[model samples]
Target chain A: MNLKSPREQEYIQQLSIDCVIFGYEDEQLKVLIPKLDFTGDFWALPAGFIQQEEDIDEAARRILAERTGLADIYLEQFRVFGTAKRSNKTFMERLVALNPTKLDDWGLDLNTLGWLTRRFVSIGYYALVDIHKVNLQKGNIDASIQWYPIRELPSLIMDHEEMIHIALDTLRLNLDQKLIAYNLLPETFTIKEVQELYEAIYERPFARNNFQKKILDQQVLERLEKKFTGAANKAPYVYRWKRY
Target chain B: MNLKSPREQEYIQQLSIDCVIFGYEDEQLKVLIPKLDFTGDFWALPAGFIQQEEDIDEAARRILAERTGLADIYLEQFRVFGTAKRSNKTFMERLVALNPTKLDDWGLDLNTLGWLTRRFVSIGYYALVDIHKVNLQKGNIDASIQWYPIRELPSLIMDHEEMIHIALDTLRLNLDQKLIAYNLLPETFTIKEVQELYEAIYERPFARNNFQKKILDQQVLERLEKKFTGAANKAPYVYRWKRY
Candidate 1:
């Protein structure tokens, strides 16, 4: 189905919201990306336009839910991309060329095409979700939805790579003050897992002793029962976020 | 002159930029606001619409320079306010009521009036400037431009009050990491003065010794020759930002 129909043109123009959904598993930081079905090689962050009646935050939440099948996740507005030439004219041209019949089938005329392909100021939002719990949905526009490791991100469409960098920088800056990492973990997990997440984000290994001391000093975690493993001498205790 | 005219209708639609200009003086945190000439009781942050050819950051910088008469100041985009109801209906009504003759005088018809008062998705940028250095300009729309202490801010038009709150929260969050306080200080200042600025921002007092140690440890400051006071045994050492 055509996402941008003539009916949608009545909504706010030239504003869009893109989600940089971050997930962690297998000791790697990952980002959720949607492969464009029409372009075959192009992948983009899950994004959508805001309706006239909806709040921008609500639009972000809707996009997140539509792609990941999750709602009320930890979402933040990090930055705005409002450069005059943010939309790649070459990419749009290629997209148009590749899907001329499809565009006609969807009732998109030259006017609608021009409107759809114009430069947009997108508000970038980042979401943190537990990789294990999310029920990912392959939306109509995407050929497939999958998480790619942050260290080896694929070439993304239209300044999305820069958006990801800004999101990571914001996450790193807020890591301590806000309990953001907790969203990426299970309800209960070992302190070692938490340390690994931090190390992956910062791209540096923390000394075991010092990392434990620093996390404990934050006083935002509660020690829980030990996880038993057959080969372990003394299994490390698990932790749950302490209610403030 | 009507800020919104047929000429301005050619600019980018649905997007605007508002600046929360912060300043420090008299041991207080203050924000720059302009009193609307049309609506006597209404005040707003210095703001403008994004032009078709200008980058959003450049739009922000232009607005800042236009209002404060200072260029190349420390500015950062903090958040975007995109609720559908961000522009208060009551305030717009009052403004229209007070400026009917002016609107007619400037050739603003019903369509232009409706367009001017419609909801906008504003990108919020915050700036820190030396209060002493700003050459405040009372613009055509504003009756007067003045700095109001953050704690005792007058009731502002639209969501500007909330914007100020968010700006302060963002500033406090980045205070330590970015050495943002230096932007609010003069080129040279005493340690005690620095402490007072922090105290004002945080709304609390810091122990003299601990504050001194903390500021000194940042290594961003350079101690200079003491300013002599006739009655003092030893004057506090003046410090300036170290040249990078």
Candidate 2:
């Protein structure tokens, strides 16, 4: 089959980017995943191909911004998923075979279908956002994207579930840096709020005193004004992540 | 100029692996780098192409073993360097032009010279090993690999110095987990030895009491038999990384 296709010509054929947008709300951790409507709720991380001259991290940020209109995201390049046969030939090619009209609409022909079967070295970047803050309006983004509680992730497509798990593990491992980097929390948050964030991330409870002592000892947070709840004597102090 | 080359057919073309071997000695941190004889002082990290059927991590381990001959070193995939023009085409092409006889020795032609200029998304893995323990023998490995102190590195080719810097930053950020994963230390070590390792890594001095408290708080180490100096009270307790 001929390799030339004007539609795919603008992209770097061998490289792709996937952005895993993670969210935390109500003491539970979540991830933003898209469900492809044509494939009956087939889910995957929002992915995009890179332009010829673009940097990989810039491509990731572009993809993330296209999917979610949120800006000022701090994206971490977590891992490169580079298995030689990572693309599922049957899933993609069969979809094309089953729906020839869809193929035409997508500007893909029998020859350009090679794009589906060829290898891609995907660079994965993950960003953290507050779940309550994310109000995704799926206007221009073609797929239905939603935040799924990580533990209750629906069936995902083509090793995406594995990617989510790895992203979460990376998120947990580098929680302090990530949380500070993204400013995911309020500027001044109570120790209880910090503890809730930890509980959600770790999916376990921590002893209040030990967790508080550990956070304080890290010296990353500076004590600020007492939390104004109108309880004068019993008010707890709110702190901000010290900017350095 | 046709694409067929029996010499270059076995490997994955789009992906390659570069291993950064770090060493700590005498309160200094060093990196293992190789100098290419063809391009004078053309230093690159020891890199190898991954085979089509090999797993990425397995490929990294294989590359590390082949270069270092050390089997048990733990390799960490730190980052993926994926700029489109990452390959230095003029340098490589000029070298080929200048030395046609050398090209014949390496079994390369114009077609396979495309191999030198093609876009590659390189997966980077960094490993830590004791400087004293690494005795590199240049038997099968083609290049002369040597350890240079992180600060004193010579001119490196094609963004390699940047790679080395990122690898060192990653090494410092993930020091505890990395130190435990590789078993780069002796089976047992003293607090002073641990302090020296930290100083080498951080390139700064840490107060004895604070450093000891921080290490102990991590609780990854288990106290073992005391150093048999026969001084009794003064001899420090040696410890091993606790097996979980």
Candidate 3:
């Protein structure tokens, strides 16, 4: 076999971006994942390929808008997974097993498949959007969309679980700056709900008085005059994020 | 061309790791960069290629030792840069200009050139090492080594300057943890030195009294016996990290 010239190699393959969109509500951590039209019943993170003209960051933002129908929320790049095995033979094997003739069976081109499975150096960005802000959509196939609590996350397509773990670790470490206050609760919530959110994350209950001191000290919440409906005592004053 | 078999098409190229080793000395933040011995003039960060059996993290540790003879220091993966132009045509152009047929002239394997210029996905780990702990070595052919204060870094070889910037940003954001402190000062130092180090990073002097109160309250530092540095004025008391 004649050796391919360096220029002919053309082996620098396509790149894609994967997003692990995180949200918190009802004291449960959640990730916004979607179902693909092509892969019947299979769920995957809302990911998309980078266009030649787009920066990776922009590609992620565009993907978020196209898939979620919500925009202008804050997102942060946490990690980039670039190992050669990122999209290894296992991915192709799984695809082939689903349908041996699926290359043409699905609308996916062979070149597209190669590009899709190319040594994808994925940039993982985790977005903290208010759960209510998410107007989820099924990507070309599924019947309905919903937020799956992270603990019950489905078998993700690739190393997505690892990506979520990384994002959560980053959030936990930077909780003071990137407060869970905005991302995890309802727009208008009672103090009990706020305490529940922290308790869920800390995996234990915090002293009510101490937690109140810490939260109030941040000056990120505004106490409302009205109380939540049907509460037991004094209807604990409702607190809203300073700028939901 | 007939499609290359997947096994044959999958090229396991070389992997290399580089560390943006940072230190603080004399109220300035510095990085340990190498003055290349090959060119005998150009400067670059200390880097070495990964050996076949080593993990990427191990490769970083090995490279650190080869360049600085430093071991068992804290190293954290801050980012990975895999830009198509990280090793742009400039390197090849320089090499080709230096010797029209150097591969043949020096009996070097020309195959190495393809790999050298091809895409490299480098894992960057930033290390905090006490400037005193490093024993610099002329580890590779034609390599000279020196420390460059980050603010005045010389022209670097590739995306290394960007790597340093990201590392510094990571350090700055994690100041509350004081994770980067142990790497900056001696095993024992005065509160003044600690304040000076932070000032160097902050790029402005902090109120001495306030700085002391804030830092000491963190409980990560333990005061030690007075240092007799032979300097005047009531030798300021020394302190060391408690290694919690």
Candidate 4:
């Protein structure tokens, strides 16, 4: 026999999503995060609450498209963060500052308000999109959006900076396996440029001959002719992804 | 300034823990789960509601100990699953079958009984422990505990099965990095044994010479002069992981 009513059950559950967007360009690895319109222009990763009818993955895709104007990009679930203090005082303060009217406008009760502000376990997904493909737009909660080179990111809300660091580490470990698919580069790039991308991520200088030999041995890249660049004595040969 | 009373916050805020317990032995990877006693043997991953005044990780660790007698094992956050449907229909049917007295025992309101089921966004963490180390026990709500190898599993409650499969795939991708630390092997074993383990996971017959070369190149293992069993004459060299 059914003991409880459905309405009470419905009121207790909640769902949300967080996205880690990676972009490779300008010899720097960048992550796309929401720039909060609070406290002299703060920033955080783009995230949102899920609707009753929407799927989590669909929510991620929708949010990515809404904020970046890109569709069909390579996005994958990474890890979930569900700490008790997911939105601690520091985080909610920022949220409140971002939009003063949000709480009252929603007519949220103290309990409902706490549930919204309390421990949230968010599924983290990473999307690798070519930097050129993104035409970034502000989120509903933000007045502006931008891609900051990961190395030079400003202080982020909550533990978002830590989240980005973890995402980058994940990329480094799975680069060989995951590199085959996602389009984080131009249609074609030089060996030097590719190496530079790795360098930016690895944050170290790699031996040139050894690096080239290692990648070439993987048989994952195809070479293309290089056009003269007038300034250089010889144009480096360009290469595009051969297999994913 | 904080707007809500602590009592009001308590009504809204809560914590919980879930475990994906993985075991490997006899050439198969398995997950430990339980059958709900109240729900006519409906299945679920072994989990528990977290108590107040406990850290999130502590809650997971405590649950692991109370359920399985396991302590000090490698546990990593995988992903959280929190869809509204996660706790709908099937869950309550199972719960009603398992706990006829839950509503009365918990002092839950008849009118708001279903709503008390509320939304739970679980933080999923996977623990890799030596199966031998677990002191598995059936809980008050569970009829019995069981281990199902990845290849053979019955219909799971909610998305628990999907969660296990995802964990398994992640484990495979992480095998090389985790070979030494994850207790995927005995303290000492022959190269042939290690090869067999990998072959079992990859589900392919790797070329012996190539496999040996790759293993040697990683410098993760150290060869030993000792050999075991009644066939030492034909046996390969014994090897143990070099401490990381």
Highest lDDT scorer: 1
Per-candidate chain B TM: 0.92, 0.87, 0.84, 0.78
Writing each residue's lDDT as its tens digit, candidate 1 over A146-191 gives: 9999988988888899999999999999998887789999999888
After superposition, the stretches of candidate 4 with alpha carbons farther than 4 Å from their true spots are A1-16, A94-117, A180-182, A206-244, B1-18, B38-41, B50-55, B82-85, B94-123, B186-193, B205-244
lDDT of 2: 0.72
lDDT of 4 by residue, B1-244 (tens): 0011123223223223568887767877678887766545577787765444445676778767766787776787666665545553457655665667765565543344443344555667778777777888877666778887777886777777788877667767887875633365667777777787777666678888898898989888898875456664766687888875
Worst 10 residues of 4 chain B by lDDT: B1-10
Stretches of model 1 off by over 4 angstroms after superposition = A1-6, A225-233, B1-8, B225-233
Question: Candidate 1 clashing pairs?
Answer: none
lDDT of 3 by residue, B85-108 (tens): 455346555645664654455555
Using lDDT as the yardstick, the better of models 2 and 3 is 2
Candidate 2 regions exceeding 4 Å error are A1-9, A93-111, A130-143, A178-182, A186-195, A205-244, B1-9, B93-101, B104-111, B130-135, B139-143, B177-182, B209-239, B242-244
- The alpha-carbon lDDT assigned to residue B17 of candidate 2 equals 82
What DockQ results do all the predictions give, each relative to the true complex?
A: 0.78, 0.40, 0.14, 0.23
Q: Native contacts retained per candidate? A: 0.73, 0.41, 0.00, 0.22
Q: TM-score winner among the candidates?
A: 1
Report the C-alpha displacement of residue A175, candidate 4, in angstroms: 1.7
TM-score of 3: 0.69
Rank all candidate structures by their lDDT, best first, as comma-separated numbers: 1, 2, 4, 3
Better model by DockQ: candidate 1 vs candidate 4: 1
